[model samples]
Target: MPLYQNREFTTLMTLKNSRLRIFLASCILLLGACASNDELDSQANAAEQQIYSEAQKYLRSKNYDMAIKALQQLESRYPFGKYAEQAQLEIIYAHYGAYEPEAAIEAANRFIRLHPQHPSIDYAFYMKGLAAYSGNSNIFSRFLPTSESSRDTKHIEEAFTEFAQLLARFPESEYGADARARMVHLRNLLARHEIDVANYYFRRGAYLAAVNRGRYVIENYQGSTAMADALAVMAHGYLLLDMPELAQTSIDTLKVNYPDHPSLSDSGEFDVAQVDEADQSWINKVSLGLFDPPQPPQFNYEP
Candidate 1:
């Protein structure tokens, strides 16, 4: 072979080898990049799963604040994962367990808005109602002479509405029976509240207002225990307003339904003063000097 040809052949081989090395290096770098991404994804998934598990553990131990934090982290980190919605629901439960009613309501509302078709939506509604119900009560209800029916019922009304929605939408829900029971209690409470307000009006020389409130109770809550007292208030209010016909009608209804009611006399005429003195009895006035005399449970007309 000629020397120049031999040298040219060696040069060609060297160039081919150099190109092969560069191609192999490029392939290795590309493979390394893919592997790195997979590793990062696996790490992210692990972190999310770990956080969710931690939240569950916190919940089981009743550490609601910790559970809320862990759940929030999981949701923020894995917003599109299968566990994201579940975590959001858990946050609501955690808020409820922690006695954070407003936060629980907000979270429940958010869940309902975001996943209207979710299967566990009933749970959200139940929790929302439960939160409202709890929020309506205070420590004073148990200790004071104050009547619950006479207090503000805004939260109770809100709760009743929520429970009603739940029952209407999901008749066979697991929470249906409990919600129904609460509704019954709430209805009674509202009826009694109307009676309380009517009694107040009757005491303040507002006969017409008292009659309206009493009539409302009769029309809206005919079966309630407060109906007897409501009828008495109506009869007395009508008598004071010089409406004998309406007063006679109320007296007749009261006699038929509540023959033993204290507001009535043997003659069946409205005896307003006797009922008033009984309401101011000394037994209810002895509050042991701790608070104002316990207001009598029943109100008596002063007309």
Candidate 2:
């Protein structure tokens, strides 16, 4: 070989060796950086798991406030961690256990919105309905024997709708049977609420309004336990409105379906003459129920 060619070949070999060394060094640095990242991720996951375990302990002890706080911290600190979604779901149960129904419902809703395809999404829906159902009772009602059917129907209706949605979307869910049972109770409560309003209107001589409420119950709540009372209210309202045919129809239906109802006489006649006497005299109104006190008429049905 010629001398100049030999020197050129030696220079080319040196340049290629330097380039390969730099490439190997770059790959080593990248692998080290990747290892460091993996270590940090493992540490973060361990911390998240620790917080979640603590939260679970709190929940098992029924210390719902602490459980909620710890769960919130875990969710916020490790938003993408493996435990984050589980923390969000348990937050709902913590709130529910604390008897904070509105908070539970809100948390459940947030979980549903954030993790629509989560495997436990049915649990969120079930909890939402259960929270609403529990919210129907106030602090006073918790201690007292107040009737839930007489209270505002807002929470009751909301719970019913939520349970219905759960049934529609997760028909085979483990919570389906419980949700269905609660729905049946809610349906009866709603029907009884309509009957209560009808009785109220009837007592105040708003016969047409009473009739409308009774008709609403009959149309929408046919199979409920309140059906007997609804029929009685309808019969009384029709009688007051001077619609004998309608009254007779209502009475006949009551006789066939609810023969043992209190509103029915032993001879199968409609026995609600006292309801007609519910109108208050002007003196009774002026006396604030002191003199000639008006008796509030009631649907005579076994509660």
Candidate 3:
């Protein structure tokens, strides 16, 4: 079911009759040429096929270390031989199967970069993206500090970007179906990450921070419910900072973007619900639209 194998199977099954005959003739010619070649060269070519077979057997047994070693040996022994491409693909599997996602990503990326024009480039890109994406712990953990299990999302984004490239550059590739699915998941994760950071700054009462985060969500996330919340939060943060012009801009967003959003009565914007009644009365004086829009109270910080 992997993109590489699918391509091989299709190549074998769907060859036109003329093409199949041509392929058979080519194989006969190669065999005749090999018979006439130096005996040592023929033996070495047969040994190369055996090495490939042994590597595939190890892969089938899930003996990833042995498989990796076998493939690496194959590369060292016959760098430009017929098995090099297959060796590259198996190396990715060997690393991935051994829970070495970062290593798998690097290997997959190298294959794609080195063989950009190869027919299997789509599979290489897709596998690279999968390697990086699989390294991430999850989408929700963005609010927390980086941890041992955390992978830099920069890697994940690169994977997604590669997968998208695979989709675009190889429109007829077998990689497209699953790569498209992964692309959707990655896009949603990026959007969710934006919302999580926005909510973090919003809850900390850092209006400027909240506004920047909120704007990121809106500009990036587009038509989701999260976009509506982001717009509302931007407005609320502006209001709390006593920026009426910016707050007015958010007012239209609140009304037109999400008319059905419930209005919580604690609209004074800055943690008014958590403040004492006397403190509430003071904040109401500066809160825009909620106040009469007259000259705000002038007060000095008293010692």
Query: Largest TM-score belongs to which candidate?
Result: 2
**Candidate-wise lDDT, in order:** 0.77, 0.80, 0.65
Query: In the order shown, what is each candidate's alpha-carbon RMSD?
Result: 11.5, 12.6, 23.2
Which scores better on lDDT, 2 or 3?
A: 2
RMSD of 1: 11.5
Q: Kindly report which residue stretches of model 2 are placed more than 4 angstroms away from their true locations once superposed.
A: 1-43, 273-303
Off by over 4 Å in 1: 1-12, 15-19, 26-38, 138-146, 239-245, 258-303
What tens-digit string does per-residue lDDT give for candidate 3 at 24-48? 9999999988877868786888888
What TM-score would candidate 2 get against the native?
A: 0.74
Clashes of 2: 0
RMSD of 3: 23.2
Better of 1 and 2 by TM-score: 2
TM-score on alpha carbons, each prediction: 0.73, 0.74, 0.58
TM-score preference between candidates 2 and 3, better one: 2
Candidate 1 worst ten-residue window by lDDT: 290-299
| lDDT value for model 2 | 0.80
- Residues 185-270 of candidate 1: C-alpha lDDT, one tens digit per residue: 77777877777777688779899999998899899987776777788778888989999999899989988988877777777656
Question: What is the Å distance of residue 125 in model 2 from its true position?
Answer: 1.5
TM-score: which is higher, 1 or 3? 1
